[model samples]
Target: MYAALTSLHWVYLLFIILIIGVMVLRRDTTLVCIIGIFLLGLIATSSLTTALTGVFSSLIYAITQLLGTILVISIIVSLSHIMTHTGINEVMISPFTRLIKTPNHAFWIIGLLMMVVSFFFWPSPAIALLGVVLLPVALRVGLPALGAAIAMNLFGHGIALSGDYVIQGAPKLTADAAGIPVDQVIQASIPLVIVMGLVTTITAFIFMKRDMKRGILTVTSTDLQHFDEQMNQRKAPLSKGLRLFFAVLIPILLILDVVGMIIFHLQGGDATALIGGTIIFILMAISLTAYKNKGLEKITDYLINGFQFGFKVFGPVIPIAAFFYMGDAGFIDVFGKTLPAHSQGIVNDLGNALAHIAPVNTEVATATLTVVGVITGLDGSGFSGISLAGSIAHLFSATLGEGIATLTALGQLAGIWVGGGTLVPWALIPAAAICNVDAFELARRNLIPVIFGLIVTTIVAMFLV
Candidate 1:
């Protein structure tokens, strides 16, 4: 049953507005979000003490909800780090280098290779792996470094991270906030990810081809020299047999995991567990064999570094997530007895009220959610605003009466594609730095294609749901 909107509900709405306002100004909303939580709790319980405790309680609650995602990402990053040290990562990508005989070939190979590697180890590390090995090949074959960067940004960050099929961190965050299972979010994202990836990447390739025809897309001599110097200076040694073993073993193992997921009907936590377990064994086996005497110590070191990276990424997200969680019914457990009996989630109530007063049509809802997702992405972390996207998608779905999964997936693609790395100059640093291009310029080059991608994907989503 839906409860009537209360003063607390109105206050919650104001805070949401303020949070968005702060994000628009490109400022961190963590403090604003914490204040919002405190004030909302104070109004709800009419107790300063409860409000103060609720701040910490809500953060702990958010962390609890997201711990699984954080852990999985951390462990995967750890395994990736070990792979790099053992030189297995290089082995994995060596085959792709042979295909880069032309600029057009370079573009597709680099983009596809980056996308596949990023799906497993994430885009940041994938950039490091691909940039060193493949970038020079692309440049030598006539593809500009800028084109390579754009391809990596669109394919890796826009495609892989948006869907996050392997790691599932993004979907886990969105699904938890939306009160849905992680698998549902993943399944919903499949079509949307495909559409976004194709539209943005293809549009970018066309623009790149046109630029090349005008003689404006050539890699400069200075950049090529710089890249050559960097490449010569960075080489790590590993046994040939070991490299080949992992190069072949890793993909087969990961593929089997995917096959298992299909055959056993595994999804969500079960699917993630399978992936995580495989990585653990891989990490252990590699560390032991690669560093016989120091393997045990190295494993601990990798795990520590991985978790540090993982929590660091989620740090800003915690407060933002805490604020949004307060708007969900599930957070009642976090607040103990503070919430009133029969209380509805703030977001849910707002959705119900809107549905009753001025019901949103499917097109309007899709456009509005996409806009909201983009706005939330302005903070540039790509993740800070995802909880809000999930919450709002849940609300929109309730009002629209269908396509909850599709709408949530659409919001995820919008938020991640914009803020994850493409539109945000700051988030574009990894791809930009590796390619030796200006982050702002990369973002600028990415703007048109990404926007077109979002528009096309949203339209396609309207049909699917």
Candidate 2:
């Protein structure tokens, strides 16, 4: 027998379709679009009851799912704040800028710095730190604020986030949905990440160079002024001896943490906490010794701001997440009164439908999931769309069987890599906001890089995963 449909199902379907349209055409915020979806959910679920209770429940459910993603973002942003206040953030980038005097040279260096720091701290913090440090240099050289934002988005959010080698947030979420070890997802994701990273980065560079050649871009004087203001806010310099010591000391310490993980077999959320904690500690030490009396105050202030930024970024996403979270059986444990062990989950059902259709190739499935992710991201919340892709993968992989987790990971990559801010104009807010660029234009510009990246990722997945 087929599963019974509620009027609410049709309503949600329509809501989602319209929301996707708004994202593509109007580029509305995900939360704002979800307001329509939520209203529909209320109308459908209430029917005669006018029961407001169901509406509240759906809202609560969606918000909770985004909490974890938001929490991770919060911690990273908070750490960036601490680093900024402690002056470690600038210290991290100073040596690199000294090495690259021109925008042409600055592109690779900034890209490299954005990639590395983002892998450790994640993208939000990386952008904040880099915006304060390198954005001005790029803008000053006539790189244009839009160009700077694109560069940051490509290397930081697209590359570093896609792989998630250090922070590992994306993999953990994918792994949980698949009932696979995080290591499996991480390892399987490596080749796909490399392929996507190369294709995406190269594509971005070509566009940037073309923009530079046409004289359509200029560096942002605002960024440089912001940098100066923040630098003045610091007011005290670290002793050359102390600065040199922490510079070498912090990298070595983080390296040891990585080594420890491999040797000791740490993975999943444990590893995320370990790496994140270490970064915070290193910043703490630098702050205490360098800032002296101001250390505690400034560092704590940074932490508060970081967490605040994180929460704001992810806040709207939480409700959208609740709806997607319903697609995963793993979440039913926490989300409902009860769910059966043998019950089919939303992701599983969707995947099973795709799997049962024998003519559909793996590449087709991958592409479909990416499209779903791109559509979901329009709601302006990346994490909200994750579970939908995860659910679809779970269903499809059960039929594939050979590398179910990897397929799931592949779908996870597509969902996050795109929805996380590559395509949807609304989701690109952070980079857009910092660069003082138009989020919609940023999204439009990303269409090429992201679509190209997905094409490469799909081909790589067909071979690698």
**How many clashing residue pairs appear in each of the predictions shown?**
0, 16
Give the number of the best model, judged by lDDT.
1
- Tens-digit per-residue lDDT, 13-78, candidate 2: 455555556656635445643454355434444342333344456556655533454555566676
Candidate 1 Cα outliers beyond 4 Å, as residue runs: 338-344
lDDT of candidate 1 vs native? Answer: 0.86
Write the residue-wise lDDT of candidate 1 on 1-465 in tens digits: 778788888988898888878988989999999998888878877789988998999988888877877877788889877776667877788788998899999999999999998988788878887787788888999999999999999999999999998778898878877878888888999999999999999999999999999998897888789889986785454588987998799889989998998899877777778888898888888888888888899889999998998898889999998888888854576566544445567787788888998968889878877887898889888999988888888888778888778888888889999999999999999999999999999999999999999999989888876
**TM per model?**
0.95, 0.78
Pairs of residues at least 3 apart in sequence or in different chains that clash in candidate 1: none
lDDT of 2 at 329: 39
Error of 2 at 220 (Å): 8.0
Model 1 — which ten-residue stretch has the worst lDDT?
A: 334-343
TM-score, cand. 1: 0.95
Cα shift from native, residue 124, model 1 (Å)? 1.0
